[model samples]
Target: MGAAITRAQIVEVADRLFYEQGFEATSFADIAAAVRLSRGNFYYHFRTKDDLLGAVIALRLANTEAMLDGWEGATPDPVERIRSFVRILIMNRARIMLYGCPVGTLCDELSKLRHVAKDDAAKLFMLFRRWLSLQFAALGREADADALALHALMRSQGIATLATAFQDEGFIQREVEDLLAWVEAQRPHQDRPTSETRPQP
Candidate 1:
């Protein structure tokens, strides 16, 4: 006989399966099979497919927030902090390639679900964008912070897509480095004092 599976284990397996195959493609039976349990046992833990999905979303959001924790204080330079955020994403390229960014993929899949889940996914992205905007504003760039935040968010998603399409980790690393350099160059220059225009009678 196989070892007994707990509710947490079932949810963990479901999360991976959902990430790999999407919510519609992964079923209770599939999750049960992975956990070596029956559909009835899976139901005992989750009650419904939506319930399982909610659990997955909650878990993913918590995990992502935890990863981003303390990131603000990681460096004194705002530009360095922004670069660190990108580096974190690049370092997790393999995982992102495997499961996709939870916020991005979940938001894409949200339309199929009811209101609460959709709202939660949307809120998660908003929070992410807000954080990026603050980081860009701190860099003292003259461009609109919202625009910069959107660009950064889009670049991340675009790089993840490129990784998925090309199956190349190097592509993301190269592009992230280039993007960081461009952002750094956008910082505003301090104005210099005029030489002979002031204090003349």
Candidate 2:
């Protein structure tokens, strides 16, 4: 494989390991072994675990931006777009149940360790917060857009954390449905569309 491809593979594996095993618990050798690279070769791609972590955070930020963009492009309705964000709990339920939100868990771990990249990891949540705030603003709640956005983010993190602790699939489903309903209800009464006029995401 080319050097760039090798580096991408290393970052990809490290991202998964960091999410599943955690940042502090996963060592450089563990990631190198998973990527089938020699320690020497791995060091060529990432001299230290922190270097690998920076790459992983970058990858996550890029991927999240792309996802939010896709949702934005998929629908013109802000309510439907916001629904896409809330529905992620249902979409990624299994993994969330297994390991918790990737961004939340990573930020929590890095915070506990006082890792320099804790703020970097938090940018992932910030990314979502900003995106959600825009969606709320588009729906006409400009004054409280950021607060509403943070509320949504807080709810998602809470649901994910509890789901992982309880390992309750039904609880996830129920909470997601309630969250979806809450998102839909946020649409201004004047802006709400009839069932026949509603846009499908």
Candidate 3:
């Protein structure tokens, strides 16, 4: 395989390892073993552990962009788009419970270690913040767009932290329901989408 392909493979596995085993805990050997790449080959692509971190952060940022874009295409209503964000906790509840939100945990780890790529990992959160702010702006809450977006982000981070700490899926479900209610409340009466139970305009 070409160098580019090998590098991509290493980053992909490193992303997962960092999320699961933690960035500081995951060794080059662990990543190499996972990809079945020889140490020499792995070293050829990533000279230092931080080099692997840089690639992993870039990979995560690209994936986050694609995911946020997918949600944008999934619906026209900004409220529903925001709902999609809330739904991520439900979708990844298992992993969130284990790893306490991949992006959040990584940023925390790198921050503690004073890793150079800390801000890069933080870009993952930045992507969500910007996307959520746009959706709130579309909802005509421009004044509170950033506040609203950050509110949702904070709630999710809190939930992920609690779920991971307590290992409670029930708490996740309850919090998700509450977050969805908050999203529903943000929609204006005229632009609100109706379900079967709700009266149509």
Candidate 4:
């Protein structure tokens, strides 16, 4: 194979290792072995672990942006589009159960390590945050758009963490139901006359 393909394969393997075993826990040898590349050859593609990490983060950001863009093109309705965002948990329930939310897990691991790339890794979440905020704003509550986006993001993270901890498929189902209900109730014509408690994730 050409060097470009080899390099891409190394990054792909490294991304999976970083997600499955964590960036701190995964070593260069592990990635090199998984990619079936010699240490010297790996060095030819990436001089340091940070180089691999930068590629992995870039891959993640590209993939996330593509997914969000696909969702936008899939439907024109903002509510259903936002609902599509909320429903990702149900769609990826099995992976979330096994590994927790990928973005959340990466952020937590990087934060704990005090890794300089932590902020860079966090751009994945920002893509989702901005996409959801735009959807909510299009739904006519621009004032609360960011807050709503964060709320949904937090709820998904909590459910993924608990689902991984408890291995509870039923809990995932229940939480998804409540999340859809919450989304369904956020109609543009709805009126709020009094202080209402926010729903728990």
Candidate 5:
């Protein structure tokens, strides 16, 4: 008998193939072939390609939320938090470049799929943006935080797009590092205390 395959295993394999080859280009046969399964077995897991795509998107979103959870009870300083977030992005550059940031990529590609799907994607992006906004608000720089997060998101997507076009990892890495530096500079000096400490009353 063959090894038992789980739903998650199917989604994991499909996600990689979809990102590398693209949704329109990756067929059910290709996905099944990657998993060493029959096309009918694939159908047993996912009724249709669209259905599979939706599952993949959900999986990606869950993974992101999991990452966010790890930062719970993290530093209250917004600047530091934001910097840490950017570092996380830098560390995951490869996955970001390949999958194109799940929320951003899905919004771009699956907007026309269904009203519910589009709505879900929009909500997910908004939630992440709002979390960034709250972090900036904590630093009393809500306005700048909003602008910075938007810019960072755009720059991140731009890097992923460039990766696809130029096939250059160095270019993407440099761009991301530059963006992080720019963000750090934008932070207020008051947010960073000097070595000299004032005596408390």
Candidate 6:
């Protein structure tokens, strides 16, 4: 593969390994082996795990921005936009059950380790928070948009942590339903999507 392709493969593999095994537990050798690259080759791209961690965070940030943009483009209704955020729990329930929230888990782990990239990793949550806040603001909740955004973000993290601990798909589904209900409650009654209009779970 070309150098750019090889570098992208390394970052992608490292991101998965970091999410699945964790930043501290996963080592250079693990990532190099996963990408089938020698130590010298891996070092050519990343001399330290921290460098790789930064790349991984950058990758996530870009991916998340694209996702948020997609949601914004998918609908003009802010309520439905918020619903799109909530439904991610249902859509990624299986992965959440296995690994917890990738962003949450990585942030928590990095925090515990006092890793320098902890704040950088947390930018992922900040991205979601800002996006959700905008959706809330669009829904006429500008006065407490950030607060409402944090509420949804906090609940999703709590659900993901518990889902991973309990390994219960039903719990995920139930919590997702509750979350969607909460989103609906945030909407002004006059602007609420009707039963026939709301997307099914």
Go through the candidates in order and give each one's C-alpha lDDT: 0.74, 0.92, 0.90, 0.87, 0.69, 0.91
Residues 12-81, candidate 6, lDDT per residue (tens digit)?
9999999999889999999999999999999999988899999999999999999999999999998889
Each model's TM-score, in the order given?
0.78, 0.95, 0.93, 0.92, 0.76, 0.95
Q: Order candidates by TM-score, high to low.
A: 2, 6, 3, 4, 1, 5
- Candidate 5 residues lying further than 4 Å off, grouped into runs, are 1-5, 93-106, 111-124, 193-201
When 3 and 6 are scored with TM-score, the better candidate is 6
Output the worst ten-in-a-row residue range by lDDT, candidate 2.
192-201
| lDDT tens digits, residue span 36-155, model 3 | 999998898899998888888888889889999999998988988999999989999999988889989999999999987888888899999999999999999899999999999999
How many clashes (backbone N, Cα, C below 3 Å) per candidate? Answer: 0, 0, 0, 0, 0, 0
Q: Candidate 2: RMSD over Cα atoms?
A: 3.2
Measured with C-alpha atoms, the lDDT of residue 175 in candidate 2 is 91
> In model 4, where do residues sit more than 4 Å from their true spots?
190-201
Pairs clashing in candidate 2?
Answer: none
Q: Write the per-residue lDDT of candidate 2 for residues 64-114, one digit (tens) a residue.
A: 999999999999999899999989999999999999999999999999999
After best superposition, candidate 2 residue 110: deviation in angstroms? 0.4
**Whole-model lDDT, candidate 3?**
0.90
Candidate with more favorable, higher TM-score: 2 or 3: 2
Tens digits of lDDT, candidate 4, 38-146: 9999899999998889999999999999988899999878878988888888999998898888899999999999999999999999999999999889888799999
Angstrom error of the Cα, residue 104, model 3: value is 0.5
